[model samples]
Target: MAIAELGPVVLDCPDPRALAGFYAEVLGATAEGDDEWTDLKVPGGRDLAFQAAPGFVPPKWPSAEHSQQFHLDLLVKDLDAAEEAVLALGAKVLDADDRSRSFRVYADPAGHPFCLCAC
Candidate 1:
């Protein structure tokens, strides 16, 4: 038998519903779950889930004090457009270099780092 195949990824945050909503908007998915847990499913396949973590400590990007542990790499059609859209949806640029680069780092509303990649 083969090893376990990957399923959905779950992120821990202070508010599952709100965090789920943010990912839902980003992936054009829908949030489904109660106050304790929420799930967001992308149209094609990738799935994301969120759970409420009381006293959740957000990771400080570019700092080893609190590691990010994990982050999502999102493919976008246009970097500038994606930047604008994500900014409107509560994503803050953690570190943005020259536009000529293919990827940029950002922090979600919950402070988890994710990358917007033009690939």
Candidate 2:
């Protein structure tokens, strides 16, 4: 049988609870099940799973030294408000290029870069 569609995207983090909490807050979802592996469901039948790994390395973004394997793009109503909410939820603001009015880049607790777009 051929692969149907993409399943849940799993991410390795030093602490599943922390990473799960970040996404839970950002996506307005809750972490269900155990602490070792937390599943956070998203809208439109999408889901993200965060697993605990003893040796998890946070990615370095903006620097081309190590490539960023993957990133997520989220559409928001307000950029400033979304940025504030995410920052409060442990996402660090990497940089905001004034040239782009629609999107800005931010990193999660594990330093995985993601974009917040106003749409």
Candidate 3:
């Protein structure tokens, strides 16, 4: 018999609700579960879980040491609009590499860095 698979990604955050809310706003997903740990279900059955870690320390991206372990790259239809929307939702723009490349770096409310690339 074959074993069934589970959720693809499990993300740790200092505040599960905040993380879940951010993801839900970004991906149009719904946050599920209680206060401790929450699951954000994306399209096509892909799931991203946010577990609460009271002492979570967010990673610093593009650094020599203690860099971000993983970053979500989103292909945006309009980079400007996307950046504005995310920023309005509490994401902080880390760098605007418009002179170098097409993608711009941003950090979530919890300080997890991500990228928004023009599609």
The predicted structure with the larger TM-score, 1 or 3, is 1
Q: Which ranges of candidate 2 are over 4 A from the true structure?
A: 97-100
The lowest-lDDT stretch of 10 consecutive residues in candidate 3 is 1-10
Model 3, span 1-119: residue lDDT tens: 75986655877888888889998998889998777899888876578888888888888877868679898887788888898899999999889856358899999999889899887
- Tens digits of lDDT, candidate 2, 1-119: 87797888898887777888888888887777576888888766479998887777777776677667888888889999999899988888877858357889999998788999888
How close is every model to the real structure, measured as TM-score?
0.95, 0.88, 0.87
- The residue ranges of model 3 lying beyond 4 angstroms of the native Cα positions read 1-6
Model 1: per-residue Cα lDDT at residue 52 = 88
Q: State the lDDT of candidate 1 residue by residue for 13-109, as single tens digits.
A: 9989898888888889989998899989888868999988889999988888899998999999998898999899999999887777899999999
- Give the TM-score comparing model 1 with the true structure, all chains together: 0.95
CA lDDT of each candidate? Answer: 0.91, 0.83, 0.85
Candidate number with greatest lDDT: 1
- By lDDT, the better pick of 1 and 3 is 1
